[model samples]
Target: SCAVALEAVRDEAGLGRTVAQVRSERERLTAQLRGHGWRVLPSEANFILARSSRSVWLRDALAGLGIAVRDFPGNEHLADALRITCPANETDFARLTHAIDAALAPEAVLLDLDGVLADVSRSYRRAIVETAAAYGVEITAQDIARAKALGNANNDWILTQRLLAQRGIDRPLAEVTERFERIYQGTDDNPGLRMTETLIGDRAALERLRARTRLAIVTGRPRFDAQRFLEEQGIADCFEQVIALEDGPSKPDPAPVRCALERMGVSRAWMVGDTPDDMRSARAAGVVPVGIPAPNDTREEAERTLFASGAARVLRSLDELLEVLPS
Candidate 1:
């Protein structure tokens, strides 16, 4: 029996995002497509019908990977247009992004340390909560998240201090700084919070990426922290150099990104990162800024945030590098 069709424009509201959010996302996606050398048309609906000369080839390629995209060439104007339905949620958006990247392929990849190559939620975020609670301040994860949502939080110590001040409780810079360092870095007896860090990507995957093209680490972490993470995580062999916070001005300025590329002796590099500052910095430095769907953010949210911050692409995982870049 044939199933009866429902009314039009149904489910105008999505599970996690609204219709307007879908529109916004599609607009950003269209721009991203155009940025990557695809000829994209202005879309009015949640779905985008983009034009690429290799539309059919790419469509079949994605289909082979268990991903479906509509490529209809019977139409006159849209001879090689590919119609892709927008993802319903943030998570699916990231998956869609990965699929597209795998189909398109990238040249070089720059990496972000936290939230991309490593899960720092337990280590860094936990340290912030404990440090704030030590000063008799009752702060929740949601509160800290909101505080970080404010732009320019590359320095956690300064961020913590600002959050404390926002609560009308002003402490000496030294007091807040020392307490945060003690809990975050830990002493000989304390074991420190560094042990809480964990690798998010596979070692072999990174080795594969390194083999593909040049690799570097551009992070907001301090020099010692960056050094410890690279060496301890056994990923030091993966990158040519690390431009940490102490190396130059924090992100959104492009100084650190430029520093890394200059040190690596590369003329151009593609940047992979989780934060808006990372994207902004990459854009300013003339690097191709690619956003990562951070574990902490919804895929749609990360995509939108990064695009707004000038990212050209969004990726699901660093491991996907092996798939997104051609051998």
Candidate 2:
């Protein structure tokens, strides 16, 4: 019976205008979050699930500020999500606003597909190693890493070929390209590539950008594969446009990034990616190049790599974007 009292508060009906006041307060909090560029998911219930790359950090920050918020780190769909009960008072809302403003992103962001936005350690990179072994090339993931470290390289096919050559396995370029494409594209029955990827960026941040400014994808992947990944994550619609391999020459050529910006009709924007090619493309296109190197970047080598590629800013993860975006 004691628990019933707690449950009652969840749906407690009040005087005629009391419900109206609560709804008004909820809208106020939502608007406040939206104002600071947060994606406030629609909530018909008493609580809202706000997605952010810094969910854990935000939750901890709020708690230290004398407020409690529930963070769902267990749910893959909501790993970087926070389920917060609507603020009960203006004071609470004020505190929430302060915490959120501390982290945000640029107005418009063009994101890279594989390494920058998604975790490819077990997906794309793994596929590279597996495909190489399947072709009797026998290369380690480190080989792939070393190849990626070289800036101004975008085509994975080229990277694979270079790695093989370094290992004394020189073969016809066309042959290597064929095998790589076969493994990456996959056979119908085999489902060829694992692509066991996850969003390394904040869904909430992306949503906020979408609601306010332009958010798009400029990737070297074929259009079909990029769409497949986006559709699977239910975020295909998040981006305003997608410029894939089918759109033009891949990164480092500057075509894809230019295509994205042209499609979005924006002259100035931030190009965010995890490779030197991404940095080079942004620079070539005259946009602000923001680089996020491999997730396993050690000794800040990735940072150095991006900087060398003319990246205006280099970050470790998408989670850090909110904190590092230029004002």
Candidate 3:
């Protein structure tokens, strides 16, 4: 075994390359741990000595997530410290960082795009109104809000069709969807209503939150629209995952929320959203459901509906999340 190990080293050049890779990864790991609020000691070795007040909890949490780190339980000198080996490969290094981030933060945040992150009143809601109006049915913002509160109206096209049918004007799903898409995505000669959408909350605050925990989007929007909104807002990099309609069944089904969690390699997370469907989906996925009313939603009605649908907590605004989220 000693002779085989020596042969694997392949002499001074190979050994030097291995040493450089270890040191590079170590530096990156130290910086990541420090960013997660751990007190990482300077090291000249292939591992990091990091201290956290919840070192034992972190150790257990990482272990639950299938990552292991050496921990000192009773030693007076290092009871609150963990010794983590540096991962030489990028994939393992990312897994370690994500595990550490999840352990310290306790839960990553899953966000719904339309109403929670972006104000969709002039885009999606307006599309619904116009699509209904084209069929001679007048739908108000309050009507849209009411439809969303139903919890089964996760997809906007289906919601629009329902609204039209309720008004005694039945339209084919395909026809209603075509009108909705034309209005939302716009024609070649005219920009789509999607251009009217705007982001809610402070971009800086969102970036700050993303620094502490992994962020993901689990939205009913098509994947293209979701990516376009994130890119247009210049906050695309803030999210680690985007689970869109194309990915699976829309919210209230829980499949999309669970899909996001699976993609993130996490089992614990908070889902921030605006509608009852979002709340139900998050809760069904065993995620902590946090609610924020859409700009167009009636506060009392929205809050009542969200709470009734299994929301763990409801916030006045997305920015308020900074105050209540675990540090």
- By lDDT, the best candidate is 3
- Model 3, range 110-215, lDDT digits (tens) per residue? 9999888899889888999989888888999888887788879989999999888888988899999999999999999999999999989868978888876789
What is the C-alpha lDDT profile of model 1 across 1-327, one tens digit per residue? Answer: 223223223444442355666876797678777866788877778789888776764574455334578776578777789998876567777666655664566435678798788788877877878888898887776676656545577777877888888877798888988998899888988977878888887788788788888788899898788888888889898888888988978887889988987887764567888888787787666566777866866678667777676655567877654554556
User: Candidate 3 lDDT (Cα, whole model)?
Assistant: 0.83
What residue runs in model 3 are displaced by over 4 Å at the alpha carbon? 1-105
lDDT tens digits by residue: candidate 2, 190-299: 66564567776667767755555578999887788788888877788898898988887877887887888788776656778877788778767655677777665553
Give the winner by lDDT: 1 or 3.
3
Q: Which residue runs of candidate 2 sit more than 4 Å off their true CA positions? A: 1-107, 323-327
Model 3 residue 28 CA deviation in Å: 35
What TM-scores do the predictions have?
0.68, 0.62, 0.68
Give the per-residue Cα lDDT of candidate 2 at 119. 72
Give the range where candidate 2 is weakest over 10 consecutive residues by summed lDDT.
98-107
Worst 10 residues of 3 by lDDT: 57-66
Full-model lDDT, candidate 1: 0.74
How many steric clashes between backbone atoms does each model show?
Answer: 1, 0, 1
lDDT of 3 at 230: 95
